[model samples]
Target chain A: MSDQEKEVTIYDIANKLNISAATVSRGLKDHPAINKNTKKKILAAAAEMGYRSNSFASNLRKKSSHIIGVIVPRLNSSFMSDVIAGIEKVVNEANYNLFISQSLESMKKEVSNAKAMFNNRVDGLMVSLAYDTSDIAHFESFINRGIPLVFFDRIYEHEKCPSIYINNYKAAYDITSHLIEQGCKRIAHISGNQLRNVYAERTRGYQQALKDNHVPFDDTLLIINDLSARAGNEAANQLLNLPVRPDGVFVANDICAISCMQAMKKQDIKIPDDIAFAGFNNDPTSCVIEPNLTTIDYKGYEMGETAARIMINHLVNNDDLQKTQSLILRSELIIRESSLKKGSKT
Target chain B: MSDQEKEVTIYDIANKLNISAATVSRGLKDHPAINKNTKKKILAAAAEMGYRSNSFASNLRKKSSHIIGVIVPRLNSSFMSDVIAGIEKVVNEANYNLFISQSLESMKKEVSNAKAMFNNRVDGLMVSLAYDTSDIAHFESFINRGIPLVFFDRIYEHEKCPSIYINNYKAAYDITSHLIEQGCKRIAHISGNQLRNVYAERTRGYQQALKDNHVPFDDTLLIINDLSARAGNEAANQLLNLPVRPDGVFVANDICAISCMQAMKKQDIKIPDDIAFAGFNNDPTSCVIEPNLTTIDYKGYEMGETAARIMINHLVNNDDLQKTQSLILRSELIIRESSLKKGSKT
Candidate 1:
């Protein structure tokens, strides 16, 4: 609320300099594209009008650190890195600092990271939940303090906070239906912790698709783990040992799916004939792998860009944060060699 | 320094509570492992002793915001993500924030990022240079203010700053030597921007290895580019069209090398039989790629951990950072089937 009262805005400085607010904002940050003289003029006007001192004084008084905290389950993945790249681009342009912490996929660490962010007084928070994070009690501190919180990708449903994600349920449904259309009678699903909505929704979609196609739902066909490479390899080994081998596998992620495919290949299984595979997240590995994995294109960078846009709007302008309850980006099944039972369609 | 003049440390609280410094620190942080009664007692003791207010006052005077800035060429690479993972682990443990930015391999962007980090007044800075960032002028502000600056991986020589890196020259030499021993008479080098010391050193080593093996260094054998996937593909195509096709190829990094190998495979070239390959960084892709690419292990995680430890030590205890001026981590060749020309050696 203090930001709404007696604070300097870029528009004020722009008006004084007879330039656009965009130019003023860029100039203040010393953006390289902005001419040096224009930047100097904007800086001089900002200082002369006491905007810098006033903003700094208010910031000190309110302890508004102008730092945004990001808490993710892990940062080593390609998808997470792409998301972070998009976030850093937007936040850095706005002259705000990003403080990143990883949960390493542990709920305890996630809670600790949230507490750390709260103690540090981050202006806003972005989160992607850990696999085992069932409780939302830890994030109450941010909600209670009215500090903006936004969730992306692997999110928990909170009434007050907004989330950015793709339509995982629909993506899974489409991929499973495609697999069935390709003549897969028995399909196996490899999933992550079913506690998380992302994996749970995908499972629901997979089951629904199977039922729609008049296939019997078999509990034995569903495999659950952390979606690790070892889990995938072990699942593949189990599938091979089964009396009726699964003709198709729809994995939760590309890494696990590729690992499983590789394991099966080592056993001399012919891809797209003896078995077919579909993966989620369309990771770079999906393309590099032999047979080119069929996958759902999860737009991580776009999701990140959207989340940062919403958070920055809420932070800078104090805009209504809930105009859009949920922003679900488009996701589609990308047909590739791995899942083409007969021949390449495209 | 003001921090030394009148600051209340965890040691003071620990002494008052008759506890270890670690317990006082963990208790104040609400660490889950500490019992509720112990944490409550430590909180009460700290409040009674005026440690909180005293420390806050000292922090204000010293302008210690407890944030560290990291500037890297890019973040999407597996090596970079690993490094960031290690840095986040250590800094988060010490309760320091990390502000990460990417230069996108542009010197102009690197300068801008450095300026932004300086303006944000990060307590310390960690940098991995962009390809063309030849000057240290942008970093003078941090050096002038006596802020601790540490460079890792793609670093430039600077007298005031400490650097952490693996021996790229030795790694490249060893890989090239192995290729020569594998009966590859004509070896090609696919390099990144020569402006970067990482690539430059590798180029030097490559030339030296060829000379050491009694093979004349041919200028035409070296291909230089930005090392993108497309670059790798195009370079492979060019290699095929060369007057004398190379029997082996040594790429600077795994992504490009894998891409090049894949491209070569599309042309029906037999790996390790017709043309052997070796790459750097031991990227996860290297293992996934067919024939399990022979590469150099770069140890990005360890490098990141070491850099963060040095920065935290200098920032927190004001320790003698100069004692360990430059830390060079270990690197070695990892031989796999991709370059095993004479079959299994081990």
Candidate 2:
């Protein structure tokens, strides 16, 4: 043979092995329909012949990049970090890369990020909506492209995109119900961006928990803000000045819980004595705080891994993603010192 | 001019405006040289004539996806989160997406992430070296392709790629010097992954401070490990058990410092009274920690903003990026109760 090179194609491999080109192509892509033994042989042969048909090249031919564009609310939060970690783990292993963008909690930035991702022509998308992201129209490009899409945490009520998240309402309900069982009649709630479904669901759970116990739910007890440490300090100050103070308090996050705890300590408001306290997202900061915060553990890492795994699994391994819908991960309520009014764990 | 079409080239703009095509191209790229007024006029005329040219498209044009891959050590840490946030912010603003992959603090994972990103056909790249990343050849693809690449904290040495970060050495030195000034005779130092420049720089700064202060630096005073909270607790135990205990402690990061403080508190080690302390990074936990932690305020949000700005500035503005090598932002020492030994502010 001459030194001139002839590029190896699936047809060449198929003809050499007396198999159909379609079967050879499927085997190259690691499709389960083709037996593993045959797939291995074809891959070895393709490698030997320097066959150039690979995932990226194949994706290009199909005009799709096997990439998922993800826009998050923010990057610095513990919960958000955990979620991204999970997503990175799964997506990396699946041979897909996560194009992560942060909105910095701005709806305008979120829209622009979506437009950029759309222009890049990603095969699919995963997103945790930004605070005050009301319009779903920015996501129409992905929907129009018929790309596989998944939303986690800060999700919307979009019918087109499937979502994966914990049952926030149920998780909150369980925590509130437990607080009621601890003989808390008058409860104070500190909530975050109520515009998002996560906080809204938790709020609903808090109200339902109060109503279920036949306690008159008072709107005056609800203190909503940015739910930052500063906000938590302010909330503590407001609670201390109330004419009828609450017997129990539920903070939406550990940062707020810790801040409130510090403020209460300064005011000599003993935890589990004057007011039983509970927080959400069992962040490590919860353990550092005095009396240790009791909280609902939202598994952000698990959420991220599940989202990436589901998105890539459908794109690469399975084809049932469009038919598959919502996935709800279970959340747990961890009981700790701050909420142990009846007596603590030894 | 024909109404059907009015042709314009870089030279046409250069000639019409009595400048070189190179100047015209630079102006179009938002170069520092081109005045804003001149750029606005050129862009207006170009838009009117249906001008379409991509700065990135002129590069080798490898039909690869316009994905700028990033490899961070871990996503959970506040510092890494800030750095990644900066990179993402900039990449998104430039209509380029970031394929974010974490090394999970292992060299093995870092290598794997690099492979995945490279295979993903990332057009350009950015990376913060992992705990033990000894290899640079792994980034050969981008380097060989003449693609713009940048590195930030936990960076590689003697590499030509542009880097964005604050001076870890100076920040560490300043904090150590502050502790020495506060009458700390025997100061214990908490270090991180010594293989990485960040922790190594901290150790060097600590020793340098001791030498500069006429205090004999002891090898026994240095504690090295992954600068996490768990590691800090272990270091705290070691320090507490010392025959001649240190009068002060300087932890490499805020999370570790807070954990060390809590551990010391459990042992009833009165902060600032018995042992003055300083931590790195002014995280929210630093403020929430009892007595408040005296720390080096490393702004994660600002770092992200700055990092993104530098990257986008280079990508969108000038191709003479070799002229722009590195950027180091300023950090300040925020004194609080933990390091207030001699009638200092709490």
Candidate 3:
């Protein structure tokens, strides 16, 4: 490339300062044997020559890049962004740089990102699996090579890989039970692809809650899609068109739930009185919507921190990754007006 | 480093396949000189041996990392997250990896992140300046070296660095003028740190709009803060405590504007009838909020794609960075019920 300039090396600094290359190298590394005055002069000459230390070359020999690679399904969500921010804070404080990429909810992109991270020789890898990542064969390379790998949020169960996530099953169960308590006999559910453990577990929880509450399990009430805002709108329309509409609805995420609620409202359906609502991932929009969305309040920042801490412990503290196979963070059912049925106990 | 295993090199794969190391390397690289059967055999053996190609070492010699570094003020915002998603898409499509970092709106963190990107030897850097970044000295090294650097959104003016942004000045002016035309004689403007050009230009635009409408500028009506939700609430309280409340309020961001409106609404103020509202960024919450919010609709994804394209063009195509020093993207005024005065023309 025309803009490419010749890289400045220690030899150039040595030549500029009329010193031996060995001495220049020792000074640049701040070796104890190097004289203080010579070291200062060598540093000054190195800066003047615009010599950037070859960390990549040295890291190759050391077998440690001091770089953490993060792959998420997407970055446009408030929860994911919060998670990233938390990871960034911890990673930065530990003096490790981050290489972040998104899978865009595609397993194909996830594989390519994993390959790139592996080729780049990241010290450790953190991932939130994509929607359709049925098999994690792409991450086998990291495992075979003993490179630390940690999964967060939408995770996979692997003997070698430690995962950090909230109890999606129990959270869904609690929210569903809450809806049942609000006198909802028939509750609709909106979820994402069942290939993802998060969505699958949530579905199981919803089914279990209905069974425990003595509510009949209706397969027709369960709408499965990508759980996008558009999907939520479609799901809402589908539910509204049904002969007997549900009295309550629980969505996999707040974005979709809010959109679903908006669509229902456009049809002149009243919230809570008409159909109580609950969603997961208490995103920022949960409160902005009229009547406010009742959702699961799980801290993405905490999840990110926990996952990064696990990676750091394995990479820095030499902690055994196998010792911590899975960690479940706390999640709460945040009751809001959207799910509060009229005349129900406060 | 007990978990650290011996790196499987080309020699290991060659030894396993009883082939020359040179042949193995060529086969792995898909060299046309190598037989297809030999290439397939080499790949299988490499995978079996868990051999990862050392791109970092090769990049060190080539003076190209095939990595693009991105630093933004923060990642938690919907706008920023969208921008990151867009950047990731383009960078991945171009077969380049992204090293992403957030400054958290702190100049100190921005400088440190810049240093990390520099040390990591990224081929190009994309940045959105931090809130308190008073100087561009940290970026001097990138400019000094022939590394292509591009800025987007919250940008800085530099002869060497190309920037991609929307016309914040005109967007702000248009929205302010729209409010003025709705008979809002006394309008308040909420802004952010003046050190950043986006906020400064917006403030200037608001002021010029008022002047053009023959409305006297009131310094007391101006509120400058971080433009966070909490700050917006505080600004609302401050405005309410004023001797005279503004007929309309324009916030530099949607999160703050939504929060400000919510705070005012809680105090028994009727929106549009009592005080018209307008915001920038057109965040998702803007639509979810009651009455909807009048705002500037600028595509963060488009801005991100433009910035990444610029960096890729310079790094991959050998295009002159100076040729596209500043690129202004399109933005529109989205008028909604929040800014529509009663009895005004539809």
Candidate 4:
């Protein structure tokens, strides 16, 4: 053997024990098919030879560092925090350490973060794409090295790269339909960058809902921005200045929707009477906002837990690798005071 | 000279050149006092001998992995997230990777996290103590190993471990005094576990302020809980059940104070007219809550930036390690409608 401590492979143990490499591998996992005597002999030989394997190995094998890298767009949001909390709970219980970083909604930071995670030699990786992340080539290194990658929330659907997300299209459709049932004749949409799958699907759902309801779809009714509070305020300004005002507004998220509602209220617009409102992600703010926001309830914590469990199961079993290819969690529309326009729910 | 690649020390390179180890260390950092010729010779010999150093050193020196481990109480809070964002910004610019973990407010989790970080061989460590973490013996390993550790926010002021935090005592005093100035004779204080220095100091400030104002200190007015929203609601219930309701409340944090205020509103209690409220950590919700919350504006981002800068400077300069033994960031009271009973600021 070379003097360099370049990773110990099963071949080294096989040569030492005068057994097949397959036999050494089987012995490492303590396979029942292998005879006890042979397994014991192979395990001793493997230990003597300093054999190391990433997964399914005996005490002789080098143990993993048990580090999981998490990459998200930002950490400031309650939804992202809850997702992280869920992941941390499961991972910490499994005796794994989680290293979290944010992309700050930039592809440059995302690429750099992926590179850093790779260099750190994290056992596995979980990613939630940034708002502007269009290229996923950076993840190819992990895939090539056989390191597992799982994505939650803002995910990309690449083969072998498992992704967990909610049914955004259905959620959006339900929210829009609910607003329509509230007697909103002219409804407007506040969305984010169309590049992201979440926003795109939501837009599609909104359009589909309008078409099904026989409401003329005016391109001017859709406003696309970063969905920041400032953007929401500006959207309210634009709506107020429009020739025909929208009686209802369906926004991408709660914070922005609340900001827009606040701006409209400042202009003496009565909520549910002058302009109904709806948003996604039932954030805490949604509950506190005056005439509470109508929104879609996406269980971020459950999604995070599910994503983490899938990754851990893949890491441990390695047999159900294909089962986690894609998953869609359930979402529900929460009708609140913001959209109860025609009459109070009571 | 040894077969084991147990670090190529400065002594090894110094012995090769028949010079003092101190000279080799000085030359490696490009000390200007060292003669250029001797420095050049030392560099060449160091490169040939495979002598390595930290990240700032040249390529010939085996570069450090440049990974920083950060342990926080939890990740769900906006304040913590902002601080992390600031740390990430500075560290990424310095070409370092951040690995973050949460203790879930448990000392056991914090200890395990510290051990994991130590095993991962992080170049530096930043920690925010968990709610119940009293004994910091877990960090002794890092100190014994001479690895740098910086504590931020929920910090511990050890011998050499520098801590960055706001003046919790002063901030709490200001909030309490403001309530008193607003004609609130009986002011209640809502705080977290007293084990944490942040909460303990804030509680002390609350008591000091009440004493200075000539108000009788009532033990019943001090409600200590986990400070969660649920806790805040329960505290409100307890207050409502009191024979004489406290006219003012000063919560250790904004989220809890907001929750308590919302619960009071639910009971048809008029804000400011019946009860004035103040809180710490001017969280975003502080601005959005009806009758904007009066809070202490603690700059989480700046604190994080300062902490990262201090850590990076320590790593790069390797001088004045003692100067950063502790740091106190500036905090100010933001008077909003929540606590303003006399008249509007306008």
**Strongest candidate by lDDT:** 3
Model 2 regions more than 4 Å off: A1-58, A157-160, A193-195, A264-268, A322-324, A342-346, B1-65, B119-121, B342-346
lDDT of 3 by residue, A224-314 (tens): 9988899999999999999999999999999899999999999999998999999999998999998999999999988888889888878
- Give the 10-residue window scoring lowest on summed lDDT in candidate 2 chain B: B52-61
lDDT for model 1: 0.86
State each candidate's chain A TM-score: 0.84, 0.82, 0.94, 0.82
The residue-level lDDT of candidate 1 at B296 comes to: 96
lDDT of 1 by residue, A56-136 (tens): 224546656678899998888989998998898888787777889999999999998887786666789999999899888
lDDT of model 4 at position B11: 91
lDDT of 3 by residue, B1-346 (tens): 4544878889878888898999998998899999999999999888877888878788877878898999998888899999998998999899898888899889999998998888888889999999999999888888888888898988899999988998889998999999999989999999999988899999999999999889999999999999989999999999999999999999999999999999999998889989999999989889999989999999999888889998888778889999997999999999999999996756
Q: Tell me the tens digit of each residue's lDDT in model 2 across A1-346.
A: 2222244579989988889999998998889899988998898777555555455565655655667778898887888999999988887777776778888888999888876675555768898988888877778656655667789988876777778888888878888887777778888999988889889999999898888789888888998888888898999999989999998898877888788888888899988878889999998778767788889987999899888888888788766775657888889999888887855333
Best by DockQ: 3
Q: Per-prediction TM-score, please?
A: 0.85, 0.80, 0.97, 0.82
- The deviation in Å at residue B20 for candidate 2 is 38
Under the 3 Å rule for N, CA and C atoms, how many clashes does model 3 have? 0
lDDT of 1 by residue, B237-277 (tens): 99999999999999999889989999999999999889999
Best by TM-score: 3
Tell me the native contact fraction for each prediction. 0.45, 0.47, 0.86, 0.37
Q: By summed lDDT, which 10 consecutive residues of candidate 1 chain A come out lowest?
A: A49-58
Which of the two candidates, 2 or 4, achieves a greater DockQ against the reference? 2
